[model samples]
Target chain A: MPQRIVSQRIVSLVAGLLFGVGLILSGMTDPAKVLAFLDVAGRWDPTLALVMASAIPVAAVGFALARRRGAPLLGGSLRIPTRRDIDARLIGGSLLFGVGWGLAGLCPGPALVTAAFGIAPALVFTVAMLAGMFTFNLLFEAGSRPRGVAKGSGTSC
Target chain B: MELAAFLPALAGGALIGLSAALLVLATGRVAGISGITGSLLGPPDDDTGWRLAFLTGLLLAPLAVVALTGRIPPVTIAAPTGLLALAGFLVGLGTRIGSGCTSGHGVCGIARLSPRSLVATGLFMASAAATVYVIRHVIGA
Candidate 1:
């Protein structure tokens, strides 16, 4: 109801729209293409690397601007992570994500978009992904801070 | 440089990064896809409206593009449906365990210069590269 909330919502919507469009345009939504890229032996598609390279500058500019600006338009201070250490959680998660990507050849963004096309496999992937998320919540519920605490506390926001 | 391939890749990456920047500027929230999707599982709340809207747009944009372009490429999967499902479950679990995904850690997390995100993103990229290698070379899957 607040103007800030409305503005945030609008921005979020726009961001998601653009992300989806990007996935489609990048040819990332195509599982076969992604698989081909992953397939280094047969025919390696290095397009993804180029995409990442191009994205880095855009992300860098965004980060620089947000850092300079300090607080966001919605009235809260930006919460960029300041640490750069490796841990078990990071390693474990990466391994799992890699395996999933290798098998399905569809990461989260494109997976959802492809699902919209009514592809049975994509639908299956989305369903499983949602279920996996739910399972994670159930298993690691304790790690998630209470919403009230997260909102009020300055840590881990 | 093939215009068709090069242009799309450049545009898409830029668009994704721009959207992420806009979301941060507007909402002060990291444009992490996992977090947005994960939020759906919890209890209903007014806060969910924006997340839902964002997700809807993600699904709809492709349809709009396809309608205009008159051709939507078919999706291909190397593994069977069951395996893909299992993999999805694993990703979900990993995200929960790790507290973020590539977008969260790799994009926003790295931007924030969070050590955790950096480590997470590094591990993710390395593991992904390794997995691809193994799958293609070793397993031939």
Candidate 2:
């Protein structure tokens, strides 16, 4: 039913554009800006907090709507996480991510946006991040997960 | 932050939420950047085409801004190249292990009111702040 309309590619494409532009306009693409936001002990900037806080109300509404719909509007397999157990992996890994984020003021999304801007340093960071992810898949999955199968446990991405 | 700064933060944030909301509403998929990017790696997925298309939009946003707004937002990375590389590597490994980043856990996960996401987001925020404290104030790096 959904195939006759616009494709998933178009939907995702628009989504990414919106996401990228939001990141840029919100100062998220600027590492220094992110650092200032995180540096609550030093020269603090609450811009990031406002961004997140504003984002939540809107996003929460969307999620609530989606949940009430019972299925995605586009007729694809819904993949929201249902896992509830919090474990050490989640805590430790989050700490590591936070450290990395605080260290360089870059995260996956903004890193990609900046890399796309043709910044050499950002490119290096993106490549290294990709390498880290690749290594993790190699060591952990050991080729067990076949291509196209969703990794739907704990969290994805 | 100045009062002027609030406009962009709130506007940009709403847009971000809108896109994520649309992605989930229309496609039943979360727009987790690390997950999207990581999915492209390792092997070809059935949804690779859509994923690639999504990323292309991300790449095109800068140019789009230039054409539409006549200017792009400035990006400043204060970290050295070596440091950036290390941070990127750690972020990659950590996100993969952690299963989400700021966007996933902080935004989408929290929107859905997941307990794990709340915990994860809290931890990441606390840890990130502490790290910044050590780097900027304590160690004064």
Candidate 3:
């Protein structure tokens, strides 16, 4: 392995650890806390908003610094999305995600953390989420594939 | 003020930001959990190794806290099993179609000042607030 890959792996591990720790410490992994934050008509908890308010500015600084350099420290280009168009897919999908988020207060990140506890409910949710992803992949492929595609030729997730 | 949640939330939010910053500096990758996890389901990318490593670190974090502090952070889930399943499914499909999630669109994308992310984030937050209102007030779900 090249030096860059090694550095990337180590840094990624550290970043993930920090993220998980933050989620736990911030009470983001708690469904009740998350739900309370979304409960706008009720006694709303502003902690989640505070979390975003604090995180975004700091992350903005990070992004600005990264953009200043020609490339990342590890010789890889940043993968920030360039598409500026906001279409139906984006709005529709976000609405779906929001409904789910409101229903269970478990988005992808905290859902995985919750699953780490080996609890049955979390486990069930995680499995179902994965299954949902798989189903989407199938539907996406079916919809996007060319009409004249060769047999047994498809991308596997 | 609810100092109990406020202080820790601010500190932890800072920590999360620091990690995201570090990832951008080191790997030029956005630390979007949904995008990362979503990619794992598709064809392999060169970044697969780092993704797996990051996931492993995420999974071990709670254990590390328990090891050092002798306490696992509390988690209270109120939704029933069927609802949980449906919600998980919707989240999975939605994140994929939307190409991001709270971490991606809300945090990382907004940090980059992306307009699409801004809209996506706003829409999701608004919709979530609405959904909560409907569930708790309208139908009383």
Candidate 4:
């Protein structure tokens, strides 16, 4: 069990490292690049679209392989989101997230990576993002489980 | 677009996919950045160490890049600080409430073919496009 825990941590560290590298190479960490991708009506840039298109299949294959094994190589059971019900929270929350993505091309991963450099914009944004997340917990999820870690939900950030 | 640009997108994206796959395959945990980071702000759990390990990796990526490539990529944020702050808050709150972010929903969830992720991705993509239209084209900001 102890060995399994160590392996999990190592895998996670490598995952994050690779993920950050991917973000930079894909331009997800670059606000200008992301904004250009989002500005569909403007002089749009389609490069980032290619990024997503290529990433999905790779991830899908990974999930399939893991599922086939009946368990992850490490220790934990799968904690992926399984809720089939599409509630108001999904719609409204997604829209809100989209608006925020539009406003600042920094999503959680890219934003955290950027903020690590001590850049003021990324820092401020990071702080506020944390605040917003904490506020939500206080409001709707105070006594509940970690909203993101609830049984069926996936993990990010 | 130039081949120079195209290759990076393809390569970078493939790397991301590989990263997600590796995490899921190794740990049985979906690699959603928002959820990983967001959960940490709350109470500690047995799941906490790996989460921190992952983030440390994220923060260390540039160094790894520099080691491998002999140079670090640049990050540019054009939005004003206040606007960025608001956007950050919304992302933080929205991702938690919604249960994922671009990586979680856009990449991993879609990969899983989760219905909720499909709808969330579509809705967010449309909303984001619309918001950009309003900001850039409509208001000309």
Candidate 5:
């Protein structure tokens, strides 16, 4: 079990390192670049699309392989989300995320990733993201679970 | 096909997927960022050490890269800080309401082929696209 814990930490670290490096290399860490792509009327930059398109296949294949195994390398069975119906929350969140992405061109991942670059704005985004997460928790108490129950519960369908 | 640009995302995504798999293999935990972040705020004795370390590494990894690379690219925002903060707040609220973020739904959840994750991911992507359209063209922000 200890071995597994260490391995999980290592994997998480590696994943984060790669993600940060990818953000830097793909220029996703740069809000100006992302905004430029969204600037369809002016100097439209399609760079972000290429990154997304490439990432889609990689993500798809990874998920496919992991699914086939029925378990992850570290240890636990993959806990897939079971809810299917869309609601106002989903719509609202997506719209809000997009607006933030459009306005700042810094989503959560890249915003966190780019903080290493020492960008003032990335710091702002990261702080706001954390604040947002905290605020959500306070208002809805979303993840509050019974003391001994598992994190996801697997009960809600 | 801009090999330089494509290679990075491909490598990065693959690494992220692999890391998620590794974490699951090693610790039996979902690589859900929201869940990890949430744990930070709860009871201190709830085994949050690893989660804190993981998040810390996430923030520091880029810094390490910048140190080695000499200089990192600059970040620019099209909107004010207040607007960005509001947007972040909304995203957090959405994640709580929806039960997960992109990492949970889009990456790990979808990989498991859960119907709920599929719906959530679809909603997230669609909303994101629509928001972009409105902001850039409709609202002109």
Candidate 6:
């Protein structure tokens, strides 16, 4: 592998490590803590909001600093999303995601982190999530191939 | 207000931000967990190396903490099995269709000031709040 690939992997590894630690430290790995926050009719805890509120500004500063450069330090173009259009897909999908999030108090990042700790619910969740993704690809992309279209070449964000 | 909980939450949130910043600065990839994981499931492409590495780091995080502190933090889940499965499925499908999740749209997107991300984040938060209300008050789950 090239030296750039090595550096990119290292950077991604370290960044992911820090992100997981942050998730643990913020109590996001605990589904009960998340559920507690979501239970507005019960004991409502606002700690998770505090997590987002704090993380966002710091990320904003980081984004501003990174944009000053032409490319990333590891020598690749940035993969930032450029879409500004909002449609039913965006709203509908977000609503579905939120409902699921509220139902289980686990999303992708936290669920994966929790599963690493050998949590059974999270483990099951991770498997089911992967299955769901595969189902989406099959239903939406796989069978709809045109005459000259290639496999796995459909549009996705 | 528990000062003990407040401090750690703030510190951890800051650490998450730092990580997000570092990824964007160093590799120019949005630290969106769902998108990264979704791509991993699709094909055995050359990009698998980094995604695996990043996930390995996530798995190792608690171990690293345990090594440092000599104890793992406590975690609890109150939802039943069926709900967990259904919710996980919806999250998977929704994130794939929506093209982002909390970390992607909520944190990184908002940080970059993307309008679509802003809208997605708002809608999700509202829907989550509503779900909680209905489940707790109406359904009493």
For DockQ, the strongest prediction is 2
Local lDDT at B104 for model 1: 72
What DockQ, on C-alphas, does every prediction get? 0.57, 0.75, 0.59, 0.73, 0.42, 0.63
DockQ of 4: 0.73
The best candidate in terms of TM-score: 4
Please give, as one word, the docking class of candidate 4.
Answer: medium
lDDT value, residue B29 of candidate 4:
85
Assess every candidate by TM-score: 0.89, 0.94, 0.92, 0.95, 0.79, 0.92
lDDT per residue (tens digit) for residues B13-61 in model 2: 9988988898888878887887777767767756677789889988888
Q: What is candidate 3's lDDT per residue for B1-141, written digit by digit as tens?
A: 767758888887887888889888888888888767865776665868888878877887788768877987778888899999998998888877776788888888899888878888897788888988999999986
In model 5, pairs of residues that clash are: A73-B25, A74-B24, A74-B25, A74-B26, A75-B24, A75-B25, A75-B26, A76-B28, A83-B116
Worst-scoring 10-residue span by lDDT in model 3 chain A: A148-157
Candidate 6's residue-wise lDDT over A1-157, tens digit each?
Answer: 8999999999889989999999999988887888778777788998888788889999988888778885888987766666778878888888998998888888888888888888888898888887877776766655465512231222223
Interface RMSD of 2: 1.4
C-alpha lDDT of residue A49 in model 5 = 62
Ranking by lDDT: 4, 2, 6, 3, 1, 5
Model 4 lDDT tens row, A1-157: 5888988999999999999899888878788888889999889998998888989999999999999997888766876666888888888888999999899888888898888766779899899998988886677656666443566643441
Segments in model 3 whose C-alpha atoms lie over 4 Å from true places: A141-157
DockQ of 3: 0.59
**Which docking class does model 3 fall in?**
medium
Q: Candidate 6: list runs displaced more than 4 Å.
A: A141-157
**Model 4 stretches astray by more than 4 angstroms:** A145-150, A153-157
Instruction: For candidate 5, write residues B1-108 as lDDT tens digits.
Output: 467755665565555566555555444455666656654654553346567766777777677776887775666666677877776666655655566665666676
Residue A38 Cα positional deviation in candidate 1, in Å, after optimal superposition: 2.4
Chain B TM-score, all predictions listed: 0.87, 0.94, 0.94, 0.95, 0.89, 0.93
Superposed by TM-score, candidate 5 places the C-alpha of residue B38 at a distance from the truth, in angstroms, of 3.4
